[model samples]
Structure formats: C-alpha cells, structure tokens
Target chain A: MIDVLYFAWVRERIGLPRERIETGAATVAELVEELRGREERYQAAFADLTSLRVALDQELASFDAPLAGVREVAFFPPMTGG
Target chain B: MRIAVQAEPFDLGAEVSAFTAGVRGAGAVVSFTGLVRDEGGSLSGMEIEHYPGMTGKAISGIAAEAVARWNLVDALVIHRYGKLAPGEAIMMVATAALHRGDAFAAAEYLMDYLKSRAPFWKKELSAGGEAWVAAKDSDEDALKRW
Candidate 1:
C-alpha cells in the first residue's frame, strides 16, 4: 500500500488531500494512469501532466521513475513557497 | 527537530532557544524567516494550504537531506497555513551545526529546497478577488543556486 497526497489545486480538483491505494503500478506514470481511471475528478486532477510534479518517498522524482518500495507519493504543482 | 504547520504566528527567539536548548554540540545556529510581501502590489491577503501529514514528511525529508549534505546537527522548519495578512511570517528555518559554515550553508540549502520542494500552495486574495499565485520563475532560479 502506498499513500498518495495531493496539494493546492490538485487537492482542490480532487476534493481530497490523501488516500491509500493498493496498486500494481511500477512507475509514477502508471500510478497516475491508475488514478486517472478512478473518476472524473481524478482524470481532471491528473490531466496536463506538464503542470504537475511528483515526489516519491518525499524526494523529487519524475513521472517515468519506478515506484518500487516507495511508501509515499505526492502530487503538486511547481512550488511557490519561500 | 520540530516541524509545525499552523495558522498561529511563532516566536523566533523562543524557537531558537528551544532548539538550542535541546541539542548539544551545536555551536552555530542560522535562521531565515520569510514574510508576506506584495508581489507587484497585486496581492492583498494570502491563503496558504498544505497537506497535513505529507507536509511534515516533506519538510523532514528536506531537512534530513540538508543535514546529510552539510553535516548539520539539527534543524527546525515552521510554516503557517490558512489565511495570513501581509507582512506576516510565512515560514521560518533554523539550522544548527558545529561551525558557522555548516549552519549558514545548510540553512540556505534547506530554505531553497523547501521553497521548491514542499507541497504548499498560496493564493493571493486581492481587491480583484482570490486567485492562485502562479509559481514564480525567480523561485526556481533561487533553487538553482544550491
């Protein structure tokens, strides 16, 4: 099981901050695809991957990166905090 | 190492004292406090949102990375969530080390990574109404210096 966290507009779009999901996703992209197939909100949240950034186990990771042994995954836009 | 995400303002001196008082072998401490600023006089108020558990993990991860990279002794990261007025402290960082070099560098590195890494969003509430603050290109550039 992996924990998925959404932030900012992603959370606003999905109407949730976090969820626990069991998946066969081997990569971030595959996980995103799994999420996108769940519902319209998920589809809208995962739409336009260019604006989204993914982190695996709290480290900045790309969508193509493998997710093996990763316990947490987060999706958010380019950070704006200082 | 304490990580707080709250709407309440934090006392800088108190935080520094608490951090130093808890950790030994910390000879230097460096801090950076960011305040709400009007970006081009467009934003009046700011509403910050963050994922609760994820935020702690992210901040701790970045702080750990800084500790490893710079040989820091301890670190603290406090960020405010929810609505904040102009000039309010948005976030603060405190890094402790055996030397000033480590403390200062680690503090800055942690700040840079925190800005680009943490999953917090800010929307500017202005006279025109509320709008999401687009990620600034300058913030990305600042992270590159690390």
Candidate 2:
C-alpha cells in the first residue's frame, strides 16, 4: 500500500487530501492511469498531465519514475511558492 | 543555517537581528521579504498550503546548496503557511557573506529556487471567489539561470 496525497486544486477536485492505495503499478504514470480509470473526479483532476507535478516519497519525481519501494506519492499543480 | 516553516507570523526585525548576530566575519548581510499583494482591489486574502513532511526538508536542502555555492557564513529561511491578509509578510530569506556580491546573489538564488522548488502552494481569495495561483512559466525559467 502506498499513501497518495493531493494538494491545491487537485485535492479540491478529488475531494480529499490523502488516501492509501493498494496497487501493482510499476511507474507513476501507470499509477496515474489506474487512478484516471477509477472515477470521474480522478479523471478530471488528472486530465492534463502537463499541468501537474508528482513527488515520490517526498522528492520531486518524473511520471516515468519507478515505484519500487516508494511509500508515499504526492500530486499537485506546479508550485507557486516564494 | 536556520529554516522554519510555521503557520504563525514572524517578526522580520527580530529574525534579521538574530540572524545577523549569529554570523561571524561576514561583511555583508542581505534579506528579502515577500508580501501578500492585493494585486488591484480584488484580492481579499491569501491562503498558503505546504506538504508537512517535505516543506522544511526541501527548504533546508536549498539553503544548504546556497551556502555551499556562495560560501555564505550563514543563511536563514522562514516561510509561513495559512491565511494571510494583504500586505502581510509571507516569507523571508537572509544570507550573510564576506562581500555584498555573494550575499545578494545567494539571496536571489534562494528566492528563485524557493519560488518553484518548494512544496508551498498559494490560493488567492477575492470577491470574485478563490483561485489557486498558477505557477508562472517565468519562475521555471528563472531557475535555469542558476
């Protein structure tokens, strides 16, 4: 099981902050595909992969990054911090 | 180096004084503060959200990089998350070095990295409604320079 977190508008669309998902996906992109197939809200939140950024185990990661022993994944729009 | 990610407002004056006092043999100290801008008359307030586990660590990593690259004597970063009114301080970065050039460059580098690399996301509340501020392409381009 891996903890999945959503932030900002992604959380607003998904209607939650975090969840624990049990998946056998090999990569972040595959996991996103699985999520997009789950529900309409997930589909909507992930409609445009270009606008989103993913972090694996609290470190910024690419979508193609392998999900080997990662325990946490966070999805959000590009950061607007300063 | 000191890094703080807190929901409470910080006293900029006290922070600067404390950071400066701790630095030894530094001839120049530079500090920058980011404030919540009203941006016309539409903005009512701002809400900042950040990843709990990654915020502090990410900032410290960036600060460490700044210290190494600029040979800074000391560095401090303090950022607040939660509701903030217009004109309120949102975050601050200070760097101390043996010369003004390094201090200023390090401070700018820290600001550029903090703008995009940090996990913090900001949403602006306005009369029209609330909206998450989009990350500017220019911010990403700014990081390429460093």
- Best candidate (score: lDDT): 2
lDDT scores in order: 0.86, 0.97
- What is the C-alpha local distance difference test score of candidate 1? 0.86
Q: Write the per-residue lDDT of candidate 1 for residues A1-82, one digit (tens) a residue.
A: 9999888889889998788999999999999999999999999988899889988877779999999999999898887766
TM-score of chain A of each: 0.97, 0.99
Q: Candidate 2 lDDT, tens digit per residue, A1-82? A: 9999999999999999999999999999999999999999999999999999999988999999999999999999999889
What is the C-alpha DockQ of each candidate? 0.59, 0.91
Tens-place lDDT digits, model 2, residues B36-116 = 999986899999999998998899999999999999999999999999999999999999999999999999999999999
DockQ of 1: 0.59
| Top DockQ model | 2
B38: Cα error in model 1, Å: 3.3
Runs in model 2 lying further than 4 Å from the true structure:
none
